[model samples]
Target: MALSVGDATLAALAGVAIRRKPARSGAVHRTGAPVLRDSVEAGTFEEAFFAVPAKGETDRLLHVARKTLDAARRLRRDARLGAKILTTSERVIARLTGSAVRVYEEILTLARLNRGRVFPSYDYLADATGLGRATIGRALAILEAIGFLVRQRRFNRVAGQGPGPRYEQTSNAYRPLLPERVLSYLPRWLRPAPLPEDEVQRYADREADTRYMLKSLSCRELAEATVSGSLGKILAKLGAAVDRREREAQIDPQPLTDSYNKAQTVLA
Candidate 1:
């Protein structure tokens, strides 16, 4: 099939190499070595190709994406779209090709299943969208370039375990975004909500509490103080358990030597 203008734009935005096959060279034949494909391959996108996004940025993006997804879902059900006139969200959806819409809808469905977090693998997306992995990649690139999605590369920490690499690439984390241009067309209810004032205060309070508990008080002082909440009880119990373990260690300072002595006594 011919590549659409939108697909070309998406390819450029994603840095995807969408080109015709290069001509075989006589020098390559003389070398007699296999020519490796440098283009992006399905399921071969590894962690080393991209840096992991910051946790705070991912969190912020995911929050906005969640709101956008919610609004998109609600907009789909609006009766205005069924009529000759289209709602803003409907118009946005209409702009995408039918195949692109299918791929996008499948992604949104998966995100909804994961509580607005897109955690599915490319294979999973292919199975869900009934499209090849390459096609899905192109579709994702399109959505991301249009400011309708944010794709973050993620990795699993192997921690020097029996492995070739310390970290391995995992499925990307996708967050849907509301394009800035489209935001003007959306109604107040359909638009992404601002962060609540209390959320900031609550986060600050939590940080302050953590700092006070961790830095202000020493271990002994914290253990001895009679704190009023469940957190206090948990800490107190943990301290007691640790103390008991230390005392037990002290009681049997040389367990191996003591065991050897007891064995000699029994033999004697």
Candidate 2:
């Protein structure tokens, strides 16, 4: 993720900005002594504080900054997947098409770096994502509708006072919304139950037939094959269509359950 010119300027400003540390407890005590003694004590304190660094504080802050940056980057990546475009509305599994997802991800990356300030222009997005201008526009529209972003009109004074809009991420609520995980699974409400071993074998066979039928078979043949499969096998096949759904359901459900249980305990 290369920083934009605006973002680079902001970063430079933040880097040089000095924040005042709170007054130390012994400042008065040290200053109250003889001037020579105070000077000697100040030098000693400076030597102790700056000369020999506390490895633990330095290491901890570094770790935290690294983690925060990583998390921010991941959130930006996932925000694109959250846009919810380019898939069939039907329950059948389908991969997302086009570079819209990539564009959305880049938008998120820019937003993260700029503290939610994303330039919403099609050209900006297309340039960042290498997507076509039209594709970027479509993706931006979809993203705006999904509540992940908000568009605000601003006057571009540099361009002689015409109104231009900027896109900003409204949902700074970070979660582990990985794009690979999102695209690979169905929603929890639509997910099917796990199949038994016998049903799994039957479903595997049916899946093979489904793939074959997908390659120009007649509608009647495909219908007949679908109908002839056992109910359990059909369900299992559907479940397998989005392999990560079960895992996501499992992973997502427990924390919620635990939270409910804890609340109930408090009430009781």
Q: lDDT: which candidate is best? A: 1
Measured against the true structure, the TM-scores of the candidates, in listed sequence, are: 0.35, 0.25
Question: What TM-score should be assigned to candidate 1?
Answer: 0.35
Mark the regions of model 2 whose C-alpha exceeds 4 Å error after superposition. 1-98, 157-268
Instruction: Supply every candidate's count of residue pairs whose N, Cα or C atoms clash at under 3 angstroms.
Output: 0, 0
Top-TM-score structure, candidate number: 1
For all candidates in order, the CA lDDT equals 0.59, 0.43
lDDT of 2 by residue, 108-208 (tens): 55544544344455666677788888886675554444332444322211222334522211212111112222322334432334689999999999989
How close to the true structure is residue 232 of candidate 2, measured as C-alpha lDDT? 35
Measured on C-alpha atoms, candidate 2 has an lDDT of 0.43
* Cα-based lDDT at residue 45, candidate 1: 35
lDDT tens per residue, model 1, 122-217: 898788778898888777775675577767654453455453444344677666555785565455765557779999899999999977887665
**Candidate 2 — worst ten consecutive residues by lDDT sum?**
168-177
